[model samples]
Target: MYKKVALAIAFSPTIEALISETKRLVELFGSELILIHIGKKTDELETQLEEIIIKTGLDILNTKLIWKEGKPVHMILEACAEEKADLLIIGALKREGILTYYLGSVGRKLIRKSKCSILTLIDPRVEAERFSKVVVNGTQMEITPKVISKALKFCQIENVSQVHILNEIKLYAFRMATASKGSEDEVSNTRRKLIQDEIVYVQDILKDLDKTGLKINIKITAGKWAVELVRYCEAFKADLLILGDERGYTFIDRLFPHDLEDVLSELPCNLLIIK
Candidate 1:
């Protein structure tokens, strides 16, 4: 559960869904909610936001509404940072174009830029569902522990019975680059040992989770990351997927402005990205 939640609101279809999900999360974590709207502040927009708050059933908590004038992405990120939000919830929609792998939508940008965790709902209409099973990626070995630690906090609150860990080593990149240093057999052994070592390391790091009494399974595969993850999650009916960002961003770019669009399409459930 998060301590503070920052919700970026725009006049879009995802607003209602975002608010609805926000209400559920607020109820779950008893967390403070900060509502941010970036646009020309107007009486009409205030009335609309008020109505939205009422509709969201946020009357139970003293929620704060902030109106600022600036670019949407800039204002949203600023508000989240100012509030020290542990969890930032936003929506993602595909843009109209040739559909490049890098879909630099505001949500994707926020996921990349924000230092905290983010929950992205690609579809506005999908209702907020309780998480029963969680799938967390461990490919970013350095950040895997933190990601799983946060996921375990949710599991403790949500009573998640199972967690699926995916550590996908990019075989395509490996064949081209990793083979440069070692013989065929050496490379094969190294690849096999990588997964074997990860299993032992992750299990050791997550020993505390075992006390929670949830069934945990970690598997390392060599293949396409996005394709295999989508296939595995769909088969298992994952309620939420958590991933970590490990790459260093060098610019005013919204988190990995290049690779996100290709990696994330529509998911069977929600996505939580921890930076």
Candidate 2:
């Protein structure tokens, strides 16, 4: 269970929504909520923040309001470390459009860099109106189901709509017996065995999720793994991109270790990484 939840408030139009959603998360986990506001300092701004909190009827217990002056993402990160928050929640806003975009969002940045698990609410109303719909990539490991389940529970009280499981399969063709070539049959057999191993791994993960009520959609594709996964999400219109991190597994760090900050800067949608 989470011990503390940090809500990064930029005083945008979505602050109230962020607070409401943070309240839901706080009530769910029974965790402390730290409100972080970052921008140029002014005497009136702090007073205004307090007014907003009081007017919203937000509970003050286990809730903190911090005023900092600096870059939004940098200041938020500093506060997160200072508060030692277990999870960070932020709003994802669309740029000049009604639909939400994940790129260049403070939520996305914190999701990547914060050393704790991250939760993103697209908007308070959006979160209120519908449950989370997740799309996950990189299912070669055996521990994905457990991580996904925990994240789904954290996202909403209800189960997610569809969980997309994506795997990358790379195929290589061998040339005929030439000066630098080996036996075709031998190489083919080796490739087949490796492919079989990957298939078995995927099957094991699926079996672990057999009784889960969440809708499951599986895909095995061949290409640059990350690019393909991103494309798949765009094509399917997935709501959340649930990727794995260092939480439930031991060997994740050695295997394609992810930098959340870089991913947040690039992904077009919100990312939920199990750290």
Candidate 3:
């Protein structure tokens, strides 16, 4: 569960979803809410924010809305850090002609740069929204335990009934794609054993969370991780997706699945990325 949630607000169609999601979380965690909007403090913007506040029933005394002038990603990240926020929620700004709504420049930057967790809503106004079905990727070998523990705790608090751990087989296959294997049968056997081992590992990892009454599942799929992960989420109708940041935050330095550009671009559900 998050303690302090900072909302990165902007003047776009995405703002309403940001506000709505923020409101839900604020109520859920009773979190200290901080709204950061990066732009000139214009009277028009002030009136717009006022309307949002009224609609969301935000207690002005508790909610802090900061209007800053500068680069949006930098300011939002800075503000959240200064406020000691645990999670930062932002909407995915759709780029025209893109099959999926890719994170806007600011959002992409934040995911890469922000030290705290980020929740990106692909489309915010769902008829009914609950993170009942959640998926978390456990491919970052270094942080698998930390990520799983964090995700389990989140699921326990969010009342998530079903949770999935996505494990990828990217090592040998990527290398073998160019070279010939010893034999078809040998390769198949090796792959099957790998899958079984992965399941055992995931089951062991999830033992501590079993008492939480959460249904845990492990999926071992071939091909690029981003592609397999996104396909599983779409087929499963996952409500929220969680992944860790193993790479740097700059647009070029991130670990966004080199072959799966459309993973975020055409994502089928909301996403929560942690560093």
In terms of lDDT, which candidate is strongest?
Answer: 3
**Pairs in clash, predicted candidate 1:** 101-262, 103-261, 112-255
Query: What is the overall TM-score of model 3 with all chains considered together?
Result: 0.86
Candidate with the larger TM-score of 1 and 3: 3
Clashes of each: 3, 1, 2
TM-score of every prediction relative to native: 0.80, 0.70, 0.86
Q: In model 1, what is the error at residue 248, expressed in angstroms?
A: 5.0
Sorting all predicted structures by lDDT, with the top scorer first, yields: 3, 1, 2
Error of 3 at 50 (Å): 2.2
lDDT of 3 by residue, 1-275 (tens): 78899988878866766687778777887788999989899898898988877776778778888888888888888899899999998888666886666766676678767899888888787233668999888663656676888888878777898998998766676356436646877767767777777777767777765446788888887666777778889899898888776655445335465533556667768888776
Which lDDT tens digits does candidate 1 get at residues 1-275? 68899888888767877898888887899999998888888888878878877877777348988788887778888888888888888766655574312224666667767877888765545366777788877664566787788777777777778888887765665576565777888888767766677677778768876437567788777765556676677788887888777655333234444334445655555788887
**Maximum-TM-score candidate:** 3
True-vs-predicted CA distance for residue 49, candidate 1, Å: 1.9
Lowest-sum lDDT 10-residue window in model 2:
171-180
**Which model is ahead, 1 or 2, in terms of lDDT?**
1
Model 2 lDDT tens row, 126-193: 14434456677655555566665565554444456777767666544222222255687777676566
Model 2 per-residue lDDT at 85: 85
